[model samples]
Target: MSSSYAGQQIAFLTQHGKEQVIAPILEPALGCVIKHVTGFDTDQLGTFTRDIRRPGSQLDAARRKARIGMELSGLSLGMASEGSFDLDPFAGMFPWNIELLVLIDDRLGIEVVGMAQGPGHSSHVQASDWPAVESFAAGVGFPDHHLVLRPQDQDDTRVHKGVSDWTGLKASFEQCLAQSGNRQVFVETDLRAFANPSRMQHIEQAAQDLLKRLQSCCPECASPGYWVSERQPGLPCSVCGRPTSGYLTEVWKCGRCLHTSVQTRTDCAFAEPKHCASCNP
Candidate 1:
């Protein structure tokens, strides 16, 4: 392992206290300081509250933030994080969170990304009375997870964010109820990293993933972040002895010199019968 980023300052732009989780993991391990850049309201780029629409994809937003941080601090190395919420990709039965940390190294002329996904806390409800509001808040892990409230529906522009305590929640609920034209107040869990513990956990995991990627060195060019670029599916079915959907090899590649190599999976040589189209489907 090479210390390519040792003794370097990586600029990070965040207003939601992401540094609390990111700095502790990467600073000591990478021997770099996470320069927390301020004076910019990241909410202008996009917000989970739906007030300001996020431009471009999740990766694009992260790259843009990293560039902004580098420019503000006059550093060649920069990093930024972004998170998105959706239903679980496997079954679409539960809320899911996907967090991305983008590292842009102008000195090395390369970009690397670390990603992680898991269960998320994002829920909403329309309530007309205090009892209903209490039920919804209890269900979403209020006071710790935090919340956002608005009048009428999810699209209502009158939103009150970061309601933590029970007293404050009741007050906000009344305020929204009074402001609502339909007499229904909308309440949801606040999706901010600092406010939501679930989202913060995923962000921390993303930082760890980034550290692993940075530690990996390319065999040919000796560049950092030589990681799996693609997966090949061809593992023979255990019962039928035929190719199945199970992956057989991982294609590794370098980000700088573009050197590539393939490694066969040694953990398992055959796919289960359930995964094979010929044997089960």
Candidate 2:
């Protein structure tokens, strides 16, 4: 247990059995006991199933969950996590997953977020026959990871989620197939933490990030979660000696007192000439 939060109890809000992964990482790292807070429908904030669209940004949703947990458990410190899936922005070819974990301390009026992103397996297949469905399942690591079934058009409200076995998947496929006017069913990997090992690993990484932030303390006010708040770009090009769109400094700020410090990258001193407009042009 770290010195700051030793022997403390933090409330974690979740409905998808996320505690199974999160608790194991956070409890030992932070030296705090995590109490799962239930009875609230976290799906109201959003869902991966597309049943209810997410209302706000991932950070906003995570903060809302943390606050709800605090209110329910009557604890000053709370934690929550949210995940989003999309195409990788840089390459725009492979599926990407962004996992965010939020820690809120009402006692200090501070909130900190830890984030992790990587390639994800979020593919979906629309098929009408059993052979195609089976092929898709095999490709997605079925039985180990779960699947969700819905109408091919993707507008239908009815969805069968958390289908792990072949028997359940076949039944769900036939049911969704009958409901679809085009006799097609949409099958996708279940993005839930417990259902997807890859997603759960990302969540664990986010928890580790949170642990690091929690361990970091502000030099000015001695508050936890002192981290980089902004990046200062404009690293000079090696050839042209002109500024490029590369980061020059990282602005670390204290979450409580807003005290800031600028630190330069230790990896490289100058940006490549290829990144400089003047050099490249």
Candidate 3:
């Protein structure tokens, strides 16, 4: 049950330390060598701060990044990762992080994408002065993790990012505050893969997901990237035997071919009445 890319070369485009987490997972699973493209300016395609805002949705950005790596490395296969941080989707009370890793194989004319989510994984705080920065740093798991310093009100040209030590962060904060014209320094957890351990953890999971999908083949077309794409909700309420909005089946599909299959959810055979449309109504 090996993937189609067992012996292929994959070009990974990144400046951050993505290789540390992604390489191990991909190499063992796909039996492929992950080459990092050195000179390509990935930030030109897009950035978190919207300096060079993304061309399209997250998927499009990831695909474009994959293509860029392939073109630069002269390899037909490529890989890239993108991350987004915001309020948690399932739990609105905390911050969360979402990471997506995409694999593109031009030779096969197929693309496989994987997603990972971490709730309460990222946070940001603003500090106006040196004392304020020290307090903020302790709150966001700094020193052990890194932080990014910028202007609070607007983007600053001289930003000090990837700051991990007290001396460096303090200097950056003082310098930026003096020149901010607004009297505040913006300090945030460096969400980059290398700087944030929580983010790195999620990225590793995403790599595993991509490998699993690539390993699966479509039953009908024998194409790679065959895995669960959707879920059908109709599990009967446990108490009332009425259909609920809970997922009852997992729908598998192929990236290169229009093939699909459905299976029952692994954890539960029935849904709760609290989620049942008929039972609750």
What's the distance in Å from true for residue 135, model 1?
1.1
Model 3 misses residue 221 by how many Å?
3.2
Q: Which runs of model 2 end up more than 4 angstroms from their true locations?
A: none
Candidate 3, residue 84: the lDDT equals 82
Q: Candidate 1: global Cα-lDDT?
A: 0.93
Ordered by lDDT, highest first, the candidates read 1, 2, 3
Model 1, residue 130: distance off in Å is 1.0
Q: Is 1 or 3 the stronger prediction by lDDT?
A: 1
Evaluate model 3: give its lDDT: 0.82
Better of 1 and 2 by lDDT: 1
Q: Relative to the true structure, how large is the alpha-carbon lDDT of every model? A: 0.93, 0.89, 0.82
| Tens-place lDDT digits, model 3, residues 135-188 | 877977788678888875546666677798988987788778887867877777
Residue pairs with backbone atoms closer than 3 Å in model 3 (clashes):
none
Which tens-of-lDDT digit does each residue in 70-178 have in candidate 2? 9999999999999999999998988899999999988888998888989887888889899999999998889788998897666677888889999999999988888
